[model samples]
Target: MNANIIIECKDLGKQYKTPEGERVIIERMDLAVKENEFVVLFGPGQCGKTTMIRLLSGLEQPDRGAVRINGKRIQGPGPDRGVVYQTISLFPWLTVMGNVEYGPKVRGIAKKERREKAQHYIELVGLKGFENTYPVKLSGGMKQRVGIARAYCNEPVVMFMDEPFGALDAQTRYLMQEELAQIWEKEQRTVIFVTNNIEEALYLADRIIVMRNCPSSIKREYEIDLPRPRNYVDPEFLRLRKEITGIMDKTL
Candidate 1:
């Protein structure tokens, strides 16, 4: 059976008026994400990958075109679309359990039920014992785990991630990537991940969409067939990476 189509973007565009006047950031872009699909939108900095995610999440409206989630047009942020940012946006005053329960609470889940949901995800992300710990005390990777738990606590239909591991050091970032992959494998939620790292994209994406520089548009779409726990140095992997790098070079 085909995975359900969760998101669709048709001729999406965004423009901003700056000191230099109207600037086009995205144009004539169309994309789709299927249920439980892991997709990476990668390109150079300022390539509008983040902008595209925002549009899909309904954080920002496009100047033209439309974005729909589950066949309904998206207009604003809602529980159906969960977002995790580069910075750990957890409430410092809240314990791990409290932070995770925040969403369900606001959505009117009873205290006992919300707490149960929170605890489940906390354990799912390997933070079971840290339920009472504060965000300030957790390591970078652990904090991101908390963020992921919080996002998933709501059982969102689609998760939008904007460089969720970008702020960590190399080793921690790699570990987090693997951890995220593990989580995705089990839950299988639709995911649209935005990053500038080609290797990161290759490692996590079921399909990789490369965007061009400013006046950003989809340049290429490559379906990665490499097996999981991929070796970046494998011949096929290196070939695809080099080919993507060459295309990215021309856009610069």
Candidate 2:
């Protein structure tokens, strides 16, 4: 593993036994994510993007090859990696504060220290006044905010997000994108986010890895050099979007 590369996927592959036959998802996928770099895995539906994230984050084992972080092979989930899901999986029984502080609490941090840390993240994710509110009472966007806060509360070395805003309304999705950009700016962490949305990938990723359909592998990689708080209407953004979409279509 390269010292500066925080995450490494070396010829990683995965397959599953289905009634039809053995199903392959990823095959010999090799990639590296640098420290504090926000990388997005973007591709069309059924492209094994989520499966790739699972393998990268140690949620599931790859059939072949290796995944390494910080020069050590990833055997399983650890405190160094945090995941945020598409469904905003917050505990309905726990209030906003409870959810955000859960990780630290379980890690056995002192209550006062954890509470202070959770409160900071709660405010960071814009949930200051709603600490007592449970997931059942919050809106879709707000629930995702709690999910983000919870993920960050652990202070992981890298964050894995799988289409986190996929369930939100269009307006809310855009808003969350901007908010996430701001949050990343404020607290830098290496993030590997999976999405099928080109605009979202363009807006968030320092580098975008476009994947192909099942039996997935990298189709192309784009380095997004746009300024922070990117504009969807900007000419450069639209041009790159069109170019990437055309490439994706060709890949399909």
Considering every candidate listed, which one attains the maximal TM-score? 2
Badly placed stretches (over 4 Å) of model 2 are 249-252
Give me the overall lDDT of model 1.
Answer: 0.89
Q: Write the per-residue lDDT of candidate 2 for residues 1-252, one digit (tens) a residue.
A: 468999998889999999999999896688999999999999889889889888988989999998999888998999889999989878789999999999999999999999999999999999989999988999999999999999999999999999999999999999999999999999989999999899999999999998987788888999999998899999999999999998883334
Pairs that collide in candidate 2 are none
lDDT of each structure? 0.89, 0.92
Candidate 1 lDDT over residue span 98-158, tens digit each? 9999999999999999999899899989998899999889998998999999999988989
User: RMSDs, each prediction?
Assistant: 1.8, 1.2
Candidate 1 error regions (>4 Å): 1-3, 249-252
Compute the lDDT of residue 128 as modeled in candidate 1: 85
Q: Give the 10-residue window scoring lowest on summed lDDT in candidate 1.
A: 243-252
Q: What is the lDDT of residue 237 in candidate 2?
A: 99
